[model samples]
Target: MQTTFTPAQLENPHTAHSEQIIRKCVHCGFCTATCPTYVTLGNELDSPRGRIYLIKEMLENDRPADAKTVTHIDRCLSCLACMTTCPSGVNYMHLVDHARAHIARTYRRPFMDRMIRQVLAMTLPYPARFRASLTMARLGRPLAPLFAAIKPLKPFAAMLRLAPSHVPAKAAINDPAVHAAEGPRQKRVALLTGCAQSVLDPKINEATVRLLNRLGVEVVVPKGEGCCGALVHHMGQEDEALGFARRNVDAWMRVADEDGLDAILITASGCGTTIKDYGHMLRLDPAYAEKAAKVSALARDVTEFLAELELPLPVNKTDLLVAYHSACSMQHGQKITRAPKVLLAQAGFTVRDVPEGHLCCGSAGTYNILQPEIAATLRDRKVRNIESTAPQAIATGNIGCMTQIGSATQIPILHTVELLDWAFGGEKPASLAGVEPRVEPALAAAE
Candidate 1:
């Protein structure tokens, strides 16, 4: 794991950080055991250790990224599961991010690849455009089978296949306004009305606001806030990603300065991870550096924030057994393990953990759309593990996980806050419409 960076290379901050990360590797290959691609394909290059060597050599040589390195790197889900498995504490996230940024700058992708990546970058971060694309994708969905026959068009086919049949109406919660607490405002926080999540399922944010208000927490959807940049950041669009970050920092920091923020609450764990890392990502910017650090300091996942709250007893407790799918970002990236599951259990649902919970569901932002074949493999594997536990439904934190897993399995999937909100006397989730909540035996005995 010894690095061979020159003095000139060491001058680059990214190179220096990656070199430190590379040197931390003991070549233990513990990461291979947890890596979804390696577990599925059994390729050494697909594993974190293998990729680390590729990244180290690529960085040390200071050469343009070749197809071999790009292939292995592209296949990576970036789930950060390897980070969790590594006993040496390698920051694979930062290292891989640096590698991706380098690839985007140096490696010229194939025409189709470039076109698709460009399309995703331009479309996904904007809600209106994304919704329009989804509507168009509905028409294209009928051609998915035809597209799948063509090798290059397969990703487009996956996109067509995955587009929701019906998009939800945009909610009032998405507006830049405040929902005050029912009685007294103990805390005021800004909610990230995320790009994709707002477009895909508006109820998740609505539920979060309702639940937060019930807990005496004022929730504000900051006016200028947009995408978390995670969708493009992992794609190696460094400038675009950083631009989104700066805009968000300005928006949220303005809100913080005027209204006061106890926490910048994030419902999407994937977005939460990136939002929480705003400090490290923007450290070099003299103007934004301090503000970004402050923003990251204030950031918290909804579950993380809620776990600290004195939640009311569930007014209408359900006895449904929930298979809690811990997202890779939530567990490894943010190190939030128990909050969601514990919250579900406290809300009177029997929460069950999926087997092989450390593995990725292959929904690492745009990973599923960009690499459909490998993504399908890992997703099927994840679906099998989730099904191994008998549960009435599935509860996950991120919308990406819901989209990926729900497409593969029959079990209804919902964002954790939706269920929590329902349990605390709000409307029941649509997924549980007909499924009756189990009656307790103690109550039956009394009857």
Candidate 2:
């Protein structure tokens, strides 16, 4: 893991930071076992250890990203399972992120690849554009198989397949407004009504707002707070990503300064991970650096925030078995392993853990759309493990995981908060209809 960056090369902030991360790697290769790409593709270059070497070579030589390096890095899911598996505490997430930014700066992709990446960057982070694109996708969805036959058109095919048939009307909860607590307001926080999640499934936000309000927490959907930049950030669009971070910082800081906020809650774990890292992401900005750090301190996943509350007994307890599919961002990126499951259990569902839980479901932001073949492989594997648990429904904290897994399985996939909200007297999820709850005699007697 010894690096040969010149003192001049080390002078660059990014290179210096990556150097620190690279130095921490002891070349143990423990990451290979857990890396989804390495596990599936069996390519050494596809693993964390392999990519570290490629990154080091590219940086040390101060050359543009070669095809080989770009290919391996592009295949990476950035699941951060390697970070969890590494005994050396290598910050693979930051290192990989730095590598991606470098690739964005130097690598020039093919014509189709460039167009697809550009289209994603332009649309996916904007709600109106994404919604419109979905409308158009329905037309192209019929052509997915035709697109799949051509090599360059595969991403479009993947996108068409993943687009939902029915785009629900935008939820009122996403409007830049406030929902007061149902009772005495104990806390107030801003909710990140994210870009894709808002457009894709506003019900998740609706469920979140309802549950938090019922629990006596005031939720604000702040104006000017748009995407968390995670969608483009992973694509190596550094400037665009940082622009998103700064705008969100301004929006959240305005709320914090004027109305005061107990926390900045995020229902999407992917956004939660990026939002929590605003401190590091904006560390070099003179004006935003301190404010960004403060905001990061206040950022919390909805489950992380809810776990601290004194949850009441479920208003309607049932012996519902839930196979909890921990999103990669939740378990590995943010290291939030227990809160969601603990919350589900307290809400009276029998929470079952999925086997091979540490692996990614291949929904690492835009990874699925960009790398459809490998994404399908990992998704199928994840679905198999999840189905083996024999649960009445699948519960996850991420909209991406819900979509990716739901498309391939019959089990009703729902956000964890939705299930919690339903258990605590809100309306039951429509997807859960006809899903009979098992009766546990001892638990029924206790109830």
Q: Write the per-residue lDDT of candidate 2 for residues 339-439, one digit (tens) a residue.
A: 99998998889999999999898888898999999999999999999999989999999989988998899999999999999988788899998888886
User: Tell me, what's the RMSD of every candidate?
Assistant: 1.6, 1.9
lDDT of each: 0.93, 0.93
Clash list (residue pairs), candidate 1: none
Candidate 1 lDDT over 55-103, as tens digits, reads 9989999999999999999999989999998999999999999999999
Q: Residue 10 of candidate 1: its Cα lDDT? A: 95
Output the worst ten-in-a-row residue range by lDDT, candidate 1.
431-440
Alpha-carbon TM-score of each model against the true structure: 0.98, 0.98
